[model samples]
Target: MTATTADSVLTARAVLLDMDGTLVNSDAVVERCWRRWADRHGLDFDEVIKVVHGRQGYASMAVLLPERPMAENYAENREMLAAETADMEGVVPIPGAPAFMAALAGLRLPHALVTSADVPLSTGRMAAAGLGLPDVRVTAESVGASKPDPEGFLKGAAELGFDPADCLVFEDSEAGILAGRAAGMRVVGVGARAAALGPTVHVDDLTGVRIADAGGGEFRLTFG
Candidate 1:
């Protein structure tokens, strides 16, 4: 579903951002890798990618190849994905990423990156995108559970020295969004089209989104 547009700026104590689709444009690389993996396994590309977004690579592999040993599959996919050059075509900064990150830097609010991407993949993607990652980073290994479990985002909040209730979560996938909301933070859905679960606000991209850290209770946000 198309997300609801907001003109109101949200207030929060910290900001937590998703990496792949939210801050970095890994869509093409993700699409390419997932497609190759699916084709190798004779699985449907669309279906695999549908479940791939916002999930640890191994998590998606387990769901896709239920009969296979998940650990082995994860290893294989990790190896395959790594063999790919770090810099790939279509790898770039997501819309509004530069502005959003700069704004976060300027605001001086507690901010972090929470991603379903495993540490290696997340780091590679970030390097390819050339995005300045937040100091607080929560990767797949950060928690036993993945998105939709509230672990990743919550862990990120902790790293940022803020309570979940005081953080603002930015996500593009359903699992990520669910985790954010369940963690008790105001959710901001970022994507061209977000499947309608729900969130405090939704924007097509980070373009025009502004943030201000209000010292104590919350940080204020302005969106257009």
Candidate 2:
């Protein structure tokens, strides 16, 4: 997203944030963990990652390792992946995320984090990424389905005390964008070249977005 793309036009009552690429730079951890899993299971690495990124563990495992009994693969892979990621370093905050989240707090705008990660991983990684917790957060455990299904974002909107239509979501992946739209919310595309998917607005990072109190129950957000 350009520096002056739509700073003047973007505003919302509530914001829904996707966790991984949107809020934090966990791509290194993800790539390393998944690559190891692929090697162990004799599966295709790139294909496995595409199916799994921003998705539930069991679901991704089922899609990538279809020949095994899912229950077994899910349990084992979850343990292995978690172990590998537990001591992860170099987990950095996404550009602009800290400022964006802090601005939300200053405006007191209702917001929630909606993530495909399980509870343990989500909390751990968010801390590692140096992000403050949101007022409401929906993890993979809270939903029956994953991103591209609308369940995660729908649950997040409810938890944050807003209708889906009253909220705007920020996401980096195509699946995350699809989920936000399915939930009837406008989406802001994040990350490298994610704008090609057509988010309501795009910004390079959270640092480029700001919020101000618009008074009388409304908040204003600007993209720069």
Candidate 3:
């Protein structure tokens, strides 16, 4: 879907961002890795993709292969992580993501990156996308549970020193949006796919988002 502006304005003391689809355009690499893994497991690639986005590798594997032993899932996840981290081809910033990140830094806003990717995978992808790591990064290694569990988002809010209710989350997947909501934070869906998931506000991309200091350590997010 083409990009567009959001109708509602959102305000928050801090922001929590999802990495993969929301900021970094890593769909090519992600799909490639999952497709290879699916082939190895004799599973349908399309079905694997459907359940993989916005989730930890092990979690996705669990959902896709519920009958498999946890040890097997863990071993496969490690292999997938190694393959993904080694393949940075096609990784880039989502439209307007660079500018949006700059705006956050310019406004001196408190923000955290909550991702299902492990440290190596997340760092490699972010570097490939030309984005530096955020001050607060909640990766798979940092959380016991992943997206759709709320643990990551809640941890991000706490790390940023904001109440869950005072944080705004930007996510581009159903699992991530649900996680944000479960954390009691208002969420701004970052793309058409995410918007369809029913976040509090929907934006085509970060291009139309503007943040300004709102005195008293608050920030006003103006959505187009």
Which candidate has the highest TM-score of all? 3
Candidate 1, lDDT over the whole model: 0.78
Candidate 2, RMSD to the unseen true structure: 3.1
Indicate the residue-level lDDT of 135 in model 3. Answer: 93
Q: Which tens-of-lDDT digit does each residue in 59-110 have in candidate 2?
A: 7787776787977866975785576458567788998778777777876889
Question: Where is model 3 more than 4 Å wrong at Cα?
Answer: 1-7
Per-candidate TM-score against the hidden true structure? 0.89, 0.89, 0.95
Cα lDDT of model 1 by residue, 1-224, tens digit? 12234556677778889887788877887788778888998999989888987777777787888898877976976675575445467878878888888888877877898987766777777777787877888876688977788988878888888888778888888878888888878788888645375767877788878776666746678777
- Candidate with the larger TM-score of 1 and 3: 3
Task: Please report how far candidate 3 places residue 110 from its true position, in Å.
Answer: 0.2
Q: Which residue runs of candidate 1 sit more than 4 Å off their true CA positions?
A: 1-7, 84-87
Give the worst 10-residue stretch by lDDT in candidate 1: 1-10
Ranking by lDDT: 3, 2, 1
lDDT for 75 in candidate 2 is 90
lDDT of 3 by residue, 65-88 (tens): 999998998888889899999999
RMSD of 1: 3.3
Model 3, residue pairs in steric clash: none
